[model samples]
Target: MSDSLFRLDAAQLAELIRSREVSPVEVVQAHLDRIGGVDPQVNAIVTVAPDALNAAKAAEAAVMAGEPLGPLHGVPFTAKDSIDTAGVPTQRGSPIFRGRTPARDATSVARMKAAGGILLAKTNLPEFSYWIESDNLLSGRSNNPWDLARTPGGSSGGEAAAIAAGMSPLGLGTDLAISVRGPAAQTGITSLKPTHGRVPMTGIWPRAPRRFWHVGPMARSVRDVALAFSLLAGPDGQDAFATIAGRAEVGAGPQSDRPLRVGWMVGPGFGPVDPEVVATVRAAAEALATFGVQVEPVGIPALERDFALDVFNRLHVMEMKPAFREATRGHEGEMYRMAKTMLSLPDTSMADFIDAEQAAERLRDGYADYFSRFDALITQVLPIPAHHHGADKFAIDGQEVDATYLQGATVPLNVTGLPGLSMRFGTSRSGMPINVQLVGAWHAEATILHVASLLESVSPVQGLFPNI
Candidate 1:
């Protein structure tokens, strides 16, 4: 396995390497070379490890010695910068914590290593992982893999761009507010924001997104995502948020998917979605019908005001205040700067936060009720494809909408603690990738992955890259 090997998914490469058909060294080299080539243009990855080769060699020796294998067995992947990697310069995409190193790997990182996955790099993200753009003082900005002028979508933008460009076969991304799914949509990749709390966020920043954040896999295909996810998910004692949820098992035998009831929500739960986005999603729904899925257009009134508006934003803003203070100490940086902009508003009253939580409970109950009726929910991640770099808000067919409310259909799921998968469906008229999200009931990742796996097979999203 040299740097020439960019096309194999995490599972494919791991199996070959486990059988000695390929070496970890080759896989590491392939990724490094790929990054060296296209990363300069896409800016997807911020840090490159010169010692990744050494780690691969060590893993290769263990394999040669006939040692017991871990789940990943020497696969390579990247992590969102917000997650701590022992000894890595995890700056959290800001200058305040620039060059900061944790003495121990985060619980998730340690688990991945325990499963035999190697950290190839730390991906770029927005300052504090709070914004749509993956730009900051430390790692700079990550551009879309398809077009340099557009965003890759944050705060997991770098991971999505890298995975899309085949720089890494798989990677770990944290999604709170569409950080993972939005990037998947923008860059034409596959990602999962697992059932909230399914994966631990031991070393990630803002800690506020904990209840909202999900650490999941970003890859070239549904199978790759499934493989990566199986390795990273589980309960680690360190994460209070990691509840006792059942982890989805990868297919070890002849497992067949069952016919599913899919409720497709197009508009009104949010705003006017782009005709192109609607058309692309509708086409995929038709394709899934051939796979024995009942894809019916439906409306969801739960997410309407049940999730609440300014109250929902305030809930997040209030939770972030303490973390922001801890990071900045006393001065104004991007993290603090953004924090002040939100916290400066005395208008965000304590009553609002309490009311939002009450509303969130109602939204949760509504989702739970809805799931009892349908196997999964199909919707858009972004109202449209990734916007131009300088565009302020997303507009659908000349109608303007807030970036947070529209582009990210992810917030409500977080509010309800459900699972969501971001699957690339097609390219937009501008030639950028478009993605649709499939949301499942709490702890129903197997069902969500099944639908994603089925749709990935039939839709135009099937160009799972060649050896990049």
Candidate 2:
């Protein structure tokens, strides 16, 4: 029973707990036990919440007492270590902030707890949450649950790995470029990067250039991601950018009665994608088409005109360097590779910075143009499946590219503040997970999630878990 409990998704656990069929203590203990047994190999969990069972006991008491239960009542969830967890260590994957614990939860974490979600643990991340892999000097590197030698993708890699390995049912992760979606794709889980500012960034680190950063949920199922996003969205009045009011109505089908129009693409703008990935995107598009939705191959001219990854590089380095500098001050020796690499990069030239800013606007306008004609977009989340750890270069589809190319299909969503969902849809020849990205217009999370749910019904890889 405990083994099956560890395998259940958050929604399923919540229902069982609410109905008294499964005690909160049993559910939480099952995950805790799973973590103890598996984490030595995965290294996904940074610190298990010492009071997790206590919280679960309290939730169980509420269930027995006939108290109103939250959506995630008694369900254990983890968060990337970069997100603050009151009294739990959030070391930001660096020795510089080792043993650091926050007095307050980040808005997302607090919201999750308010929804009756138990804080199961905090997961790993790259130093300062800046790299494409979840490895740092403080907590060491996290390995892919499917293939230990491969990365799970980062900076939310640990959260992804943990959820994939059944250590947690749902988790929170932050995304600047591809942290949330990329990691989810790698680990064969589901994740939602809600429209920018849809969720507050309060209590999360590297607050600079906050416009691009997002806090979102990572889970094993689309419904769980949708449930968590509904609970986590809206303003805390603390993050100025989070002024959007009211929760996004998840599970809401398209706003209109018309057939949803979705465009799928893999090239011209997203860079050299693996043929396997391209096929996966096409398969998803075709799957949707057969499901009575209008799906077609499409491209956004703005993506081609201005490579979003390059534009993001020029703009963010100038805006984000200060915060990195402030955090790494006098602690350079303790910093990890990403921090050192970020600090060593030369500042963006004034001309290039201005050009990049204009390019960003143009990209946004281009997306606006495309969205006006389409309800959503489908694309590859990453160029390829999870790569080996520490690899920096690859020959993808006959073109030699660097690791940064992995963000090609993902960064544009960040630049435009659009919402995107990553979910497994195919498998690589090497037996790794392959995921297709579902993108929606700003504040159109429901639309994309609706489409994702539809696709989830037909996903080739549905119910597939890593062989951890």
Candidate 3:
């Protein structure tokens, strides 16, 4: 029964809690037990909230008293360690901020709690949440739950791993390049990187150059992501960029019976993709077609120019380097290797940043034009499945590729400030999860999520659990 409790999705857990079939205390304890049993092997959760059980007790009391409950009432959720959690430590995966605790919850965390979600723990990330792998001086390395020796994908790797391993039902993770979606793909879960600024960034660490940064949910199901997104969206008064409208009805909308046009791509555009990864995406496209959706292989010529990653890298360095230099001015030795490598490099010149911004505009315009025709674009989240841990270089289908190419498919949506989602569509020959990305125009989360929800109904990887 405890195992069954940990296996339920957040929405299912909430329903059970609301119906008195399962107490909030029982739900929270089941997850805590799962974490205790499995997290040692994965190192996904860095810090467990000391008051989680107490919060669950209170939630149970609310149920017993016949109080009105929120959407996620009694559902346990985790957040990336870089997200502020009020009294809980948010170490940002660095020894530099080891014991740091924010005085206030991040806007997303507050919203989740307000919706009756219990904060369970802080998951791991790369130092300063900068790298594609979740490892740092503060909390060691997080192993992939599926393979144990491979990466789960990063900066949000631990968030994905925890959810995939059933240690938590749902959680929040920030994306700049591929943090949320890539990790979800690798771990066989689901995630949404809402259009930039759709959710508030207040209280999240490394919060500069807000245009490309976004925070959204990572969960076992697409509906769970939509539910969390509905609650997390909208202006928080503190984050200037979060002044957009919310899409709370996205998940609840009826599935369309009308034929939809879908575009699919495997790139000469993004980078070299593994044969298995391409096949997985193609299979998912075929599945959509089977549902009366018109699917076609399409290409975006701009993606061939590869401006997406360049735009992200240029702006990211321009915004982060100065602050990083100051933060580690004399404590360089205390920082992680990746942080040292990044901060020691030359900074992006104003002229270079200006050029990148211009290119970003072109990238956005290109996607806007393309989405004007297609309902949504589908592609690989990463070129390959989860790779071996601590690898310095990657070989895809027997050919070596730059490790940074992992950001290929995901960075483009960030450049456009568009919504993109990832879900496990198939499994690799080695049995690791493979995911596909679904991208839509700005503020088109509803459209993309609706398509994702449809795909979820037929996903080959649905109901599959990691061996961890």
Scored by TM-score, the top model is 2
Let me know the TM-score candidate 2 reaches against the reference structure.
Answer: 0.99
Top model by lDDT, which number?
2
**Which whole-number lDDT from 0 to 100 does residue 311 have in model 2?**
95
> TM-score for every candidate vs. truth?
0.94, 0.99, 0.97
**lDDT of each residue in 1-468, candidate 2, tens digit only:** 777898899999999999999899999999989999999999999999999999999999999999999999999999999999999998999999989989999999999999999999999999999999999999999999999999999999999999999999999999999999999999999999999998999999988788799999999998999999999989999998887855554467666888889999997998898999989999999999997888888878888899999999999999999999999899878987888888899999999999999999999999999999999999999999999999999999999999999999999989889999999999999999999999998898988888898889998888887777
The full ranking of all candidates by lDDT, starting with the best, is 2, 3, 1
The candidate 1 region of ten consecutive residues with least summed lDDT is 249-258
lDDT of 3 by residue, 12-93 (tens): 9999999999999999999999999999999999999999999999999999999999999999999999999999999899
Q: Clash pairs of candidate 3? A: none
Alpha carbon lDDT of residue 277, candidate 2?
A: 92
Assess the local accuracy of residue 12 in candidate 1 as a C-alpha lDDT between 0 and 100: 83
Q: How many residue pairs clash per model?
A: 7, 0, 0
Judge candidate 1 against the unseen true structure and give its global Cα lDDT, from 0 to 1.
0.78
What are the root-mean-square deviations of the candidates from the true structure over C-alphas? 2.5, 0.9, 1.6
What does candidate 1's lDDT look like per residue over 328-412, in tens digits?
7754745533456555645458777788888888888778888777888888888888887856766677887766655446777
Score each candidate by Cα lDDT: 0.78, 0.92, 0.89
Cα deviation of 263, candidate 3, in Å? 0.4
